[model samples]
Target: MAFNYRRIIVKIGSNVITQANGLPDLQRLEKLVDQIAAIKKSGTEVILVSSGAVASGRSLITVSDKNDSVATRQLLASIGQVKLINTYSHLFEQFSILCSQVLVTKEDFRDRLHYLNMKNCLEILLQHQVVPVINENDVVSVTELMFTDNDELAGLIASMLNAQALIILTNVNGIYNGDTKLPGSAIIKEVTAAGIDFSSFVSTGRSQFGRGGMITKSTIAQKTAKLGIAVHIANGTADNILLDVLAGNVTHTRFVPNKKASGKKKWIAHSENAATGAVQVNEGAKLVLTSTKASSLLPVGVVAILAEFKKGDIVKIIDERNKLIGLGLAEYSSDKAREWAGQKNQRPLVHYDYLYLQG
Candidate 1:
């Protein structure tokens, strides 16, 4: 069968990789590894963002009552990461496919330099025909710096690499119109730029073993798709889920891609969290920026500089009510931007090429 995408990100959620008792499900992992190996042999580059370290860690050690939740997690992640990566390494070894373990925290992508460095490292691994098995460095990531879940990390990786698609394997078949347990609730097969409000039907409940829920997946999927990467959410436990997704033989929710976005824009799309500065723009600027016509953020349209940042830092654009408008790379220091705010004919604070508007 012909594969649809030459490059893809596969994110396996904790719920899909762990058993009911919160232990690593080795049998299920082996099956998924077999499928990934087959996909790699078919000439497609695969980057895996997997979750199961905590579950794997839980199996190896029991925490004392004196340890708090954070301490417990750190201990588990420190120990479990080794077990999880080793399982992946051993499984891929059977097929003569080499895999590398990549652990990262939100801090890794906080700045442009760090982001590019990580990207370069992954590129080298792929060039050497090594599958990169990535996971969050839970041992070091505090609650404030943690990604919403592996789904968010996967989206970032997909956008960073300009992947053709992102396939998120969860416990559920796909996003549904109502509670999944209800008999009549149907899966929403495809999502486009139609501005559908998923919150009306999708539940906000977290997964049994994961931090995020369907809401987080849908949000990240939409953002990733807007950056020109198609996204698929499907059941990881299904037979040959990865292969079926690539072959168009699976039932899942797909977020259609825009396909016209530039690589820089894709990177900017995910930089909202990495932004260090904030600027509130006038309504006039917001309207033009969000319009079909491309426009740069001019100093004349800026109302206030809300934070201090260097010229090259990523900044958040807000509206009169302090609502986020988008994220962009600043062309000047916040001090300079403030001096020129509402002034005429100043250099654009953020050029259209580096700006990513939000909905």
Candidate 2:
């Protein structure tokens, strides 16, 4: 099927931007900028999620005696982000395309206020025909709060912007159904709302500068596709790959989107704080939440409360097996939930506007 989208999020992996020596390649970056300029001229909005800070830093800094520890990586990122964004700005300017830099740590999205601010900033830039280049703020991020990789960050950004598609540019063409190097290995052309398994073909090797491998990209594809955004994993190193993928001319793996969740529910579901607390429910409650048009989650449905949460906080609703069934805004604190657990005639714990049904 031909894929046509007006808004897109393109993610460039570190491997695509760095050489074996871990230095940024200006020529390659210029090529990408040119393609983005062409897409923008076509009147499509594009957001770029780029990775290369640590790799660029590795080229500039000397860690003579120190081991490759977390601190060393953070220090390199601090030095590298400036170089990365500067190079990008220069390249985009050559095409007369203005660009803006957006650095986000996981905490930025975790906090509601910061998330909204980031969204607004990107929207404003797009309004002015500026491409917003995003990267993780690795320099100041604590290990516990750091984003796992750029793939996860891209997914969050795509969902936040309500993008039509997300293109993840990597070194490989796409997911293979068998060994990638094998003679007969076939590219998985399309994936519906149902998932795909490519365990045998997934690369275990990390990129020279990035932490993510194919597994993380696949995970991101799955998450974003579930939110009704198509995801394409194509080889960034290929000639004009970004443009080809956007035009549906590239040989790539495409994950089709599921039906969309409501705007408020989508935000609540994608909230980073959703997993902080949970309410376990009986099978009947799960059905009710999934099917009923009711406004409130009745007390009779909640089987148990798993963690402490406050009113207006997002919380996960899990089944007995501990699998996530849905997400909802809590109507009461965790303490209140516990008090009313297993009791009848209590107020609804979560309202429907705050609930997101699981895919």
Clash counts per candidate, in order, are 0, 0
Compared with the true structure, all predictions reach lDDT values of: 0.92, 0.83
Predicted model with the maximum lDDT: 1
lDDT of 2: 0.83
Q: Write the per-residue lDDT of candidate 2 for residues 1-359, one digit (tens) a residue.
A: 45668899999999888887778866788888889888888888999999998887877888754666888888888998898898999888887888888998877766467778888999999999999999999878877877778898898899999999999988889987876778988888888877866455676777666788888888778878988899999998888988888778889999999878665665776674435778898887877777746545777877888887887777888888888878888888999888888778888888877777765
Off by over 4 Å in 1: 1-3
What local lDDT does model 2 show for residue 44?
Answer: 86
